[model samples]
Target: MFLLYITALIIVIFLLETVVIDLFIVRGVKPDFILIITVYSGLFLNKTTAETIGFAFGLIQDALSFKQMGINSLSKFLIGYSIGSLRENILSENVIVQCLFTFIASCMNGIIYILILKGLFYSEIEVLDFFKDLLIQSLYNTFLAPIIFFMLNKVHFNNVREFRGRKEEARTD
Candidate 1:
């Protein structure tokens, strides 16, 4: 059931990213829905589940992207694992924290993607332009974080504790 939900979410987000999201593009930089989802999964879900979702979504994005493959997958996997590991220590419910996480995650994703491309393909990325784009993308993702967080909060998958409690109750009974 969780897998099904994730699949549906990836499809919907992909469609929206390709179609509707472009309409709101500012300065040729668009909000990364996949990155946002990956971060959200990490912040809200268990580490294993978050990493799985991140890898799956990143693979899908890589397949659809014209850039080199596997970059997104690796970056998202790391982000998911890193952020999800903070679930116990961080105050994830705060809006500021969510935005900060999104910002940092977005920056990390951009840096990882660029570094991989540069190292593997000998791509010459201008430092200033790269930093400019990275900042823009991070801010854009941060701006959208709260809204996405609210929506994802309403999702049943976020209720992992309740599901576990029910299973435990059944086992005891």
Candidate 2:
């Protein structure tokens, strides 16, 4: 049941980010819902679940995009795993923490993609354009992170164990 809910949510977000979000783009900037979900899941979910969702959604995103394949999956999967690993160290209910995570994740995502493009595909790249887009996208995502987290908080994910950001004998499941 949890998987079904998450899958459906990701599908809806994927559609929104790909199609509907085009209308809201401001200066070639838009929020990355996939990245937000990846981070949110990492904070509130189990390690394996967070990484699984991140990689799967990234793959779906890659399959549909025109850019080099595997880039999204690799970056997002790493972000998910890294964030999940830090749950214990960064336990908090603060919005700033979420924004910080979003900012870092967004930057990391862009940097990884650019590296892959340059190293693997050997694509011609404009340095200024890359930094501009990366900054805008990271800011856009960072600003929206809190709102997304708040909304997702309203949705009860009953079937998964939510790590309390620390080790405890009590089980969430």
Best candidate (score: TM-score): 2
Tens digit of lDDT per residue, candidate 2, span 61-173? Answer: 89998875799999999999999898767753578889999899999999999999999888899967998989998998988888877777667433222434234434343
Q: Model 1: which residue pairs collide?
A: none
TM-score of each: 0.87, 0.88
Worst 10 residues of 1 by lDDT: 155-164
- Determine which window of 10 residues in candidate 2 has minimal summed lDDT: 157-166
Question: After superposition, which runs of candidate 2 have C-alpha atoms over 4 Å from their true positions?
Answer: 157-173
Candidate 2 local Cα displacement, residue 58, angstroms: 0.5
lDDT of 1 at 160: 57
Point out where model 1 deviates above 4 Å.
157-173
Q: Give lDDT tens digits, candidate 1, residues 32-119.
A: 8888988888877789878988888888889988876899999999999999898767767789999999999999999998889888
Candidate 1, position 100, lDDT: 92
lDDT of each: 0.84, 0.82
